[model samples]
Target: MNAQELRDKTPDQLRDELANLKKEAFNLRFQQATGQLENPARLRSVRRDAARVKTILNEQAAKAAE
Candidate 1:
């Protein structure tokens, strides 16, 4: 949801969350393509959330490397 919350999660949990967000993003895209998407905003939010998870993951990896 938020970076702070995501920061608190273990890498495994973060990966799982990222996967779910990707799935939701794909479904949202499909719904939009079919003209069935009720909330277009959700797509944006999911994308951002996925990005946040990725950023956090990278940060963790970088920290470990250091």
Candidate 2:
């Protein structure tokens, strides 16, 4: 997903997406270990997306706390 799409998600949705991304990253790692992964670049993309979700989530949380 693009940054715009990620930014459009609600906090709860972002959290859910983060969880799902992490799960996908784990599976991708497993696939790489077994030489089944087609595109290794996906790992980097997933990690970056996960980080973006987390950063947005944290920003929202901080705003709420203020």
lDDT of 1 by residue, 4-57 (tens): 999999999999999999999999999999999999999999999999999999
Question: Per-residue alpha-carbon lDDT of model 2 for 1-66, expressed as tens digits?
Answer: 787887788998998999999999999999999999999999999999999999888888899999
lDDT of 1 at 24: 99
* Top-scoring candidate (lDDT): 1
Q: What local distance difference test score does each model get? A: 0.97, 0.93
Q: What is the TM-score of each candidate against the true structure?
A: 0.98, 0.92
Off by over 4 Å in 2: none
Candidate 1 lands at a TM-score of 0.98
What is candidate 1's CA lDDT for residue 48?
96
- The 10 consecutive residues of candidate 1 with the worst lDDT sum are 1-10
Question: What is the lDDT for 40 in model 1?
Answer: 100
Predicted structure with the largest TM-score when compared to the true one: 1
